[model samples]
Target: MKAIREARGISLRRLAKDIGRDPGFLSRVEDDKQGAGPGTLHLYASYLDVPLAAITHKEIPRDQERPGSPHGDDADPPPDGDQGSC
Candidate 1:
């Protein structure tokens, strides 16, 4: 997540503001000291123009979050023991 943000030349402050979150909160999320909820992840995906899987590393079931969105089953699941490292 941090890498993608940096590679896109987006500052932490800018991302936080765009996502409607505090910079400190986003900083903690980037550092792995905190977890972003599904709604927050959605915000990130929407703001970054990426799929939820890109922000979560796992596919959200078709019937779960995105409904008719393109990010279901087709996403590659994370490796063994992986946990939201996107």
Candidate 2:
């Protein structure tokens, strides 16, 4: 999520404001501490101009991360990095 957001050049503050969330809370999500809900995922997908599946498909934990895999599709999260349940 963070990678896509960064690739699109979306800033933490900007994305948070656009989605009606706090930047700090969003940050927690990125660090894998908080979880982003489906609603929030929709907001992020809409804001980022990407499909929800694109973000939700493969979020796995670092421990479960597959070798040579391109991305992490482990869990839902809040903001900060929204990996999408915070």
Candidate 3:
């Protein structure tokens, strides 16, 4: 999560504001001390301009799928299909 945030160059405070959450709360989420709700996850994905799947999907082992490739099922699609545009 933090990786994605950094990749997007979004600060915790700015991300929190974009998500309508508190910076401290977002900080906790980033540090893995807190779990974000589905809504919050959606917001994070939207604010980062990345597909929610990129954030929520679990990486499967190569052995779990074809050789040399990780595969996993897509998470339930982002709640509203359209997370609010910035």
- For residues 1-86, could you state the per-residue lDDT of candidate 3 as single tens digits? 77566645678888888779999998887777888899999988787766777666454222223332223344345568489887
lDDT of 1 by residue, 1-86 (tens): 66556646789999988878999998898778899898888898788777777766543334343332346555666679778556
For residue 60, give model 1's deviation from the true position in Å.
18
- Local accuracy of candidate 2 as per-residue lDDT tens digits, 6-63: 6667899999999998988878776667889988889987887777776664553343
Compute the lDDT for candidate 3. Answer: 0.69
As a whole number from 0 to 100, the lDDT of residue 76 in candidate 3 is 47
Q: Which consecutive 10 residues in model 3 have the weakest lDDT in total? A: 61-70
For model 3, the stretches where C-alpha displacement exceeds 4 angstroms are 57-86
Candidate 2 worst ten-residue window by lDDT: 60-69
TM-score result, candidate 3? 0.60
Task: State in Å the error of residue 71, model 1.
Answer: 24
Q: What is the lDDT of residue 37 in candidate 2?
A: 90
For candidate 3, give the lDDT of residue 6.
Answer: 64
